[model samples]
Target: MAVADTRHDDTVTCMAARLLRDAPEEFALLGTSMGGYVALEVIRQAPRRVRALALVSTSARADTPEQVASRDRQSRLVEAGEFDSLVDAAFRGLVAEQHEKDLALLDIWRAMARTVGAAGFLGQQRAVVGRADARELLSTITCPTVVIHGADDRLIPIEMGAECAAAIPGAEYVVIEDAGHFLFREQPKATASAVADFLGRVDTSH
Candidate 1:
């Protein structure tokens, strides 16, 4: 993915369509945080093409007013050349207590922020804040789905994963303890195992 903002594909639906225009006829989807939103949109757009889904530390609900305001404030700070506070705020809920002080992990996050820069951040903020509620999209998704969440995720909350699993028929749910919003990174082995198992069980013979 470009990793930059939607880059003119502002809406989730539009971005999903963009990916499908040249994507494989069928593929697995593993979405983390905002990516979960995009993946749901993709399912909505083309359920037939998605062989499986792995939703990680994300929600299907619309942004709360407080969340929108907070994102806007953070965007402003980025515009004003003050990104440290924003990063600090985001990082606090991103990892377990032990990994919070890990320089390597912190560096990876910092590098991503710097790579996206101010413009991409603003675009993403707009896309997220304006995104739709995907709760209703769950029932329509027929692909093999696994909902994974950090047991101690501060950003998306653990219950959100259960809610998604409950909404999506036949969706398996897993929790990674000692992880936070950045669960896949914090517990890569477990995360990969879950993903691999799900893919292996998929009925691709059709």
Candidate 2:
């Protein structure tokens, strides 16, 4: 439940270091979206310390050139005080088209952006842009693992989740139907059920 500040750390490696400094010797890790990239770095840095890992709506690959360019553009916009527009743009991509009509959900995301503030968002964008390709580390993961993707996820495709599960030795995979990038928010029951089932099989007795 410890939430380390990732705003200042501009790379997954640095974020991983900060995580290890505060985390217990052994702990289960759960991450979604950008957090997923950070979680994979943690496993790479301290494989023996993680009891299990759960990745939701994320990918193990580095961003495509177009993606990086878009992120850079967004970063500039945020730095110039277009924070509200950045959040709005992100929200449009983070959910299924239908969820765009969900005013409550839209408001919640907007509030999150405001809470983090412009500086924090820019830092996060830098970290996200600087993240490395973690696909090679998947085969080295010995702990139990779970991968959850939304069937209608617009940000990261469902194929990315499948490939992540396939790379891991014995990773469990789940697809939340009718959900998008924010599957946990869009489909809580299914997301919680998948997490519960994964936890049931994890041995954190040590």
Q: In candidate 1, what residue range of length 10 has the lowest lDDT sum?
A: 1-10
Backbone clashes in model 1, listed as residue pairs: none
Angstrom error of the Cα, residue 70, model 2: value is 0.2
- Mind giving the per-residue lDDT tens digits that candidate 2 earns over 21-135? 8999999999899999999999988999999899999999999999999988988888788989879878988887789888888898888788878888777778888888999
User: TM-score of predicted model 2?
Assistant: 0.96
Q: How far does residue 69 in candidate 1 sit from its true spot (Å)? A: 0.7
Model 1 clash tally, residue pairs: 0
> How does each model score on lDDT?
0.82, 0.89
Off by over 4 Å in 2: none
Candidate 1 on 1-206: residue-level lDDT in tens? 22323555656777677777756788777888988888898898889998888898999999999999988888889889887668766786688766788777787888877877667777777888989999998998888999999888888988899999999999999888878888777888988788788778887544
Model 1 score (lDDT): 0.82
For all predicted structures, in order, the TM-scores are 0.91, 0.96
